[model samples]
Target: MKIIKFGGSSLTDAISYHRVKDILLREKEDKVLVLSAMQGITKKLQKAIRTALKDEDEVECIIKEITKKHQIVATQAIRDTEILSDILERIEKKMKRLERLLYGINYTEEVTAKSRDMILSFGERLSVHIMEGIFRAEGIKSRAMEADEIGIITDGEFGNATADLKHTRKNLKKTIGQELDRGVIPVVTGFFGQSKDGYTTLFGFGGSDYTAGIIAYSLDSNVVEVWKDVDGFMSADPKLVSQAHFIDRLSYAEAAELAYFGAKILHPRIVQPLEPKGIPIVIKNAYNPDRTGTVIEKEGYQREDVIKSVAYTRDIGVIKIEGVGVGCKPGVLSFMASTVSEHGINIKSVITAQTSINFIVDMEDLEECYKLLRKKHSSAVEEVVKMEDEALIGIVGEGMSVTRGLAARVFSAIAEEHVNVDMISYGASKVAFYLIVKGKYIERAVKAIHKEFFKV
Candidate 1:
């Protein structure tokens, strides 16, 4: 069995949907297809939710546009007139439900975490509905299923939740397994799942990939194919370095480190479930399926290159805490960690000295992170500093773990460019080395390292 996932761009319109159908039909193995929402739908829903929180009626216009967009895709893609009509009816019903939710939020003038997740989930829900209709119209027996319906239960962390692996695995085998056995292709929604209490919970940004991971693990599928618009994972962002090349293979750890450090091709969480099982993940181009995309598995490809890719993220901020007693205090670091966790702010990386500490976190969480630290840890922190407009550049490869002088080579390349390093950390797995620099230097740093390591 195979579990396949298509990104938003792969199903943006009628043409894309038809292409996905063709790809699935050609697959010889029994497969489960997972889909993200059409491009721009999730953003529109998020905007509608924000407008409702402001006690405005703007959600109607957003919902109308969303419904119309889906109708256009469904009508154009599904050839059978009767099937098209049925799909439109179902689409309308879903829209009405969304409208009611929006109206309730506007009337209450509040947007709780659970409500927000439910609002965002419509993207995947609506997309799969259209796709399933298209599949059925083409005489491919298929059923649309939501992630929650497949036994994907999570904890109550509304915005980003963790799956109860043992329970989820057992239930999915029963639910999805039954459908596959009956010769039906199950088209499942990608992102949000229900909590144990049945509240909709997200897996945070790029949650759709997480959805694919959980399903792949539960079924013990042969491979998880992630269909995207790109050719495959590259040695660097092509836009940054025109010389950047595609990498054909990577170990699970290398892929995860690159994703966490800012590779856009796959979400970091995708490897969470599949890694332990040693299942291979193929990142392929839906548009160019004949090309061999990147493959990530347990055993990495043996290559002469020690550095596989240079990844970078600009959405980063640094928090610096320092005092004579800062590092000496037993719980100083632990207190800072607890405070950030309490606020749901994730610290991406950290750098420490005898008298000071620097933390890297998502730029979106900067204000909350700074505020919480100041509010709670004022006594231990003599000085607090926030650095904005910085980027973390990472070089990832399993070969680096056994190779020496890799760090010196990385530092030399950056130094040659005169870019200042703000903070740095090597992954405990030795698969990656990430260093912070001014945001303006990202393109330069990435190109410099890619050219130095890969081209050599």
Candidate 2:
């Protein structure tokens, strides 16, 4: 059996639904289908939640728009009147429940983590119903199963939760195993799972890919196929470097590094569960199924070019703490890092010197992080600096640590572009290394590096 997951881009409209149906029909293997919400629906749901705090009328309007969007897709995709009616009714009921939840938030003027997670879950719940209808219309035996119902119990972290795989495995083997044996495809909702306390909790955004990995690990399936709009992972973002080409293969470590640093192809956490099981992940194009997309495995095919990709992101900032004997001060770094994390901000990387410490974080969290550290350690810290316009560039491959003078080539390419490097890091992961540069020079740096290494 195989675990097949479709991203939001693959289920955007009526035509897209038909394409997904045809793809499933062609697969003869016993497979489980995992689905994200239709494109833009999750964003709209988030919008509704924010609007609920201030304006209930705008929240209602957004809910109506969501209702109309799903209704139209169901009408266009399902030919049988009965299936269409059932799906439309289910959509209406779910929307009504969502509306009530939003209004509760409006009345209270506060959004708890639990309520927020429940509100965000409507996207996947609604899409699963429509997809089930689509499959049923074509006489395919399938059931629309919510993640919670089918035993994806999480650790109860409201915003970002990890599945309790041991319990989940037992529950799934009992629930999903029987269905697979009877040849019934379990069309399960991705993204959110139920906590042990029986409340809805989400994995982070773009977490549907993580959901697919968890299911594959539990079942020990043959492979996990992720269908997206793009062909697969590329050597660089084509928009930044026009010469960027497709990467046909990548090791699991290489893929994880790429995703973590800035690659949008897969979620950073996706490789966690799959790696231990040695489950190979195939990234395929939903629109063009005939194309052989990139495959990520334990021992991936090595390229002639040692560096598989140069990935970069501008969504980063640096927080510099400078004081006399700051690095020598006991527990100062630990105190500051613990404070930031306690407030739910993630530090990407930390660089320290004799008298200074630099904390790298998401650009959006820079202000709050600086404020917190300043308030907490005013006497111990002489100055706190927030550099919000920094970009991170990462080079990922299997043999990077063993390769000779590869770092020199990378620096030479960037130096030719006359871009100044702010900070550099290495040896943390043998498969990858990253450097920081000014945001303005990121495109030039990426293009130059891609050209030098790829020689395209």
Model 2 off-target regions past 4 Å?
301-304
Error of 2 at 109 (Å): 1.0
Query: How many residue pairs clash in model 1?
Result: 0
Itemize residue pairs with steric clashes in candidate 1. Answer: none
TM-score for each of the candidates: 0.97, 0.97
lDDT comparing candidate 1 with the true structure: 0.87
Point to the candidate with the largest lDDT: 2
